[model samples]
Target: MSAINFTDVVFQTPRRVCHSIWDGLPGAITQTRAMRRLGRYIYRRFTRHTVRTQSHYTQFMRNPPLLDVLARLLSEYQIGSTVKLASIGCSTGAELYSALYVLRRARPDLKILATGVDISSEVIKAAERGIYCPGQSAATNGLYLEGRPELFWEDAKALRDLFEVQHGGTLRVQDRLRKDTNWLTADATEGGLADTLGPQNIVLANNVMGPMDDSLAEVCLRNVMNLVEPGGYLVVDGIDLDLKTRVLATSDFKPVLLGQEELWSADGSKDGWPWVRWGREPLDRTEPTWELRYSIIFQHARV
Candidate 1:
């Protein structure tokens, strides 16, 4: 080959490869993107395989802002009335139970029909069981509260009492909560999700489809939104920003504000005294220790 031809061939080969990679950047489906997506899928698949020892991800007081919004909603919806609540992807029932316990504490007379759903039968059964290790409670409730407890201690205690802590600290949720809350297994991605369960006054789908494809997430969210009763609330924190933006851009839905720091203050100020963080990681103890509090408490505009 001639000298110039040889040089051209070397440079041309790389340019084609570079062009191919850059091309994938813009389109929905690219070879590079597909491979990376497949890698992630495989990793998750394997991680799920070791479920026997894996700690199902969870957080304490996942979002206090939702509680604040709920409190406000109650006052406006009705001074004392029956409200329906549904927690999608309720995973082991922590979030579902938390909502029920907190709301019931606020309005002792208000009747709440709560539903908890997930895709995994084992997890649903575990949720139905309503049991958690002691460490689980301390991480969510203990560290987040840090030094303050009097304000929330009563409600926390009421919930803790509902558990029958047996030998080895396997806490079982008592009949009081289990009787009122229904647990089931259902896929959110399908159209049947709405028909399977009727409308709800408050629908929580947080941390459910975060790991799924954005397109799939959007579809599931839309289906879930349809199930919300008119003027009802929907919470989906785990969703992607793109999906949220597109979803909110529509006239049908409006984004709900999160109190954040406002939730911890006496008057609920975003720039206030009480923060949802701790100065130091405290040692383990019998009581729960709350160091870092929950992240954004997402909400949805009533339609």
Candidate 2:
């Protein structure tokens, strides 16, 4: 065999042992506040640098609670018949379409104008096509290798309603769902994005900012905020908690406390904890500012 890697040899056994212990702990013990806090500390100590990849990874109906909250917010807050929404970093448009589906189902009377923006032209093009094939490679479709059509949804009826199954199990987004939706390729971190996209009643920058360094993520967060109209809502998740809290502190955007815990511990996010850089830490209610730290949705106060 070729030369062995000393780093793996030195660390692998200890890591495995730690994982075994963690897994062996009963839920009752592991769920305790003290234990959770300790786990968070360990995670922070060992967290790796987030690698920014062009991998367009997403899932349909990823967070039902979040989508339901968005539906409620739009229904209660928006006035006119037409509602404008945007999804920055809309990879393959799964989240964007999911939002559209929920909103349409929730408020059938309102006409929705949606825009999906991504920095990758390839993903943008794929999103516009709205066709996903099982086992398709990133080279052909710009989707992550693990991105399968079946992962789009668990409910068969819902999948049938949203997509038209093509030859060989490929799924194409339905025409009604695709209507009035624009796909544009642009960097969310770049300035003047607000001017180009105009103000939106709801802006989503979810599951996309975690890979960037803090400086770039902060810049992107601020730029993304500009796209939201005053009194509108911003749905953000999967960014550094400290960065999010720090940036929003200076702005008029106040956290929406409803469903804060549900959103924070969302199934899509909670499972990755401590192991992945983008993973979310356990929610700690003991923290005085827990509400601000856990809330993923924010509303811009009207000037």
Candidate 3:
């Protein structure tokens, strides 16, 4: 049989077809075929983009509102004096870089070590290179308007100068870069997290919970909580869980509803395109945090 070009096949149809025919043997065969076709479609999409762009657009979002919320949450807790920050699902290093910039501006005197972990070696390599898409820089610059007026190019140069790409594969904040900040690639639930971060002041898990299954998300959260100092902060955005049940179980956690100024750019620049302040009402304390709102911030209570 001649192979069909998967790219020619559309995305929505297969997902629909798979769901529509998920019962009988013939239906199962159809579903299996659809899944293979879907995989090829995704592969084609991945191959068409540069690794850096792929990392930026696919791996994660450099959520401005979430970053601002983090900075505010840290200040509320005075995190700079106590907690170093660790980021889970830190694809291509934007989250770490964002945290570093916020911390530097918010608390220059304090030492901050940022560790960025991801499951993908490809993402880690792209992050180590420290390159960013032009649009990404523009977006970051727009987000950081309150602290630094410079363009994203200047910000990128500042970041490159401040952070050191260690030969050991860890990205450390060295010398002029505040000396205390750092980043690494590892599983958050695995053995090395403790060694890499010591104890964390703030752990930022942004928009990562939804991709993993429910059980994995909970385990990941527990791992992050384990790293926090008692009274240390845990800031989370884009939680993936049944908020009603999970929030009840995790009573110590507080949900933060971001105000417009805290999220959208008042300057009305399109540079921050998709990040424009979308009002996200807090979940009923049970659904996934991100499902109802575009973004949210959470604080882990002192144990």
- Full-model lDDT for every candidate: 0.56, 0.78, 0.49
Clashes of each: 9, 0, 9
lDDT-best of 1 and 3: 1
- Location of the lowest summed lDDT over 10 successive residues in candidate 1: 272-281
Ranking by TM-score: 2, 1, 3
Model 3, residue 109: distance off in Å is 2.2
Root-mean-square deviation of candidate 3: 12.8
Q: Give candidate 3's error at residue 5 in angstroms.
A: 37
Pairing residues by index, what is the TM-score of model 3?
0.53
> What ranges in model 2 sit over 4 Å off?
1-13, 48-54, 77-80, 135-156
Model 1 C-alpha lDDT per residue in residues 1-303, reported as the tens digit of each score? 554663465456653454345345643443344443432332333222222211234443555666756766676556568888998877677777767767776776788889988776666776776766644432232211212211133344545655676787566766666767888877888878888888888898876665566677788878888878877777666444435555655636554444534433322212210111111111112212111122223344553
Give model 2 RMSD, 1 decimal. 5.2
Q: Candidate 3 — worst ten consecutive residues by lDDT sum? A: 141-150
Model 1 regions more than 4 Å off: 1-56, 136-162, 258-303
State candidate 2's TM-score. Answer: 0.87
lDDT string for model 2 (118-160, tens) is: 8878888878888876445222445343234425334545667
